[model samples]
Target: MTADGTAPTEEVGGWLDKLGALLRTVGLVVAMGETSLIARNIREPEGATAAGRAMNPGLRQEVVCQPDATGVPWWFWVWQGPTRDAPGELEPLCPAANLEWAAERITRVLAMPEGPP
Candidate 1:
């Protein structure tokens, strides 16, 4: 990854750029609904709680965004409220079909703006 946090590969960079944009756009939509999408991963904690019994714990990250409040574009809203550990309830920010529709639009938007070769 670059010091600026961008991917090194062109393909990966392109995808990241698009995803970043989508994340921002969707985040706005989510914020407008008075919620946040805590995008994070699930990690198992160390150690055991009982004899011969290991208690694994999961950890996830979260971020808050506001509606019509343009500033932090990476933040999102949780459509499925909160979860036990892994961020939000893995809620679908948008339905699969709707995502497809938005993706198509994103593709067109990105295609319209080409970088230097």
Candidate 2:
């Protein structure tokens, strides 16, 4: 992490590498880590800071950011609900980047046999 709240160059790369390693463990051709949890932190355009950019290097499979609303970047927040709204989603948003508890969860999930898509 950098003093400006952006991620350091190496830090971003490291996170991306860690993400790749986690995905490889799961045998996923394309890893889909969650991001809504991390995206919520940004309120402004500049909020797409390096720290934010590096936070979710993995792909988002279920949710996407609402298009260009509030000037926040598309990378921030997971689009939730059946209508794909910006709010009211559950289960800690992105399973990949929910660093709060994901480290263990990811390890466990990756160890299990691939589930039905």
Candidate 3:
């Protein structure tokens, strides 16, 4: 964390970078979001033509740092049924250091109806 609000470790950045590359090859858009990283899908909108497609922010998750016995561990966490005051809403996805598992699980949501979803 810094004045610019990006994550402190390049470990986080590096994981995101690699994940971004994999995601793009499969047609997902990846970028640094307001607080962390975001991957979105562009599905065909009704009446879609030369106009814009609907950007669905599916499976919105953000990276968070938590303390561990070894060191500070970075993770991507998604909020489930969040309320205004509940700190227990977040559930960890995967360690930010493990991009292969993360990207696979994250992109699973994009699978077509006939594929493994």
Lowest summed lDDT window (length 10), candidate 3: 59-68
For residues 2-93, could you state the per-residue lDDT of candidate 3 as single tens digits? Answer: 44554556655666667778777877777674335666655444454553433442434344434233454445554545676766445566
Please rank every candidate by lDDT, starting with the best.
3, 2, 1
lDDT of 2 by residue, 66-98 (tens): 223233222232235677555545433232244
- State each model's CA lDDT, in order: 0.33, 0.38, 0.57
Candidate 2, position 60, lDDT: 33
Among these predictions, the greatest lDDT belongs to 3
Which regions of candidate 1 deviate over 4 angstroms? 1-34, 46-56, 67-117
lDDT of 1 by residue, 43-106 (tens): 2223435542333222223333322222222223233345555544432222222334544443
Models, CA RMSD each: 18.1, 15.5, 5.9
TM-score each candidate: 0.22, 0.33, 0.57
User: Measured by TM-score, how close is model 1 to the native structure?
Assistant: 0.22
Q: Considering only N, C-alpha and C atoms within 3 Å, which residue pairs clash in candidate 3?
A: none
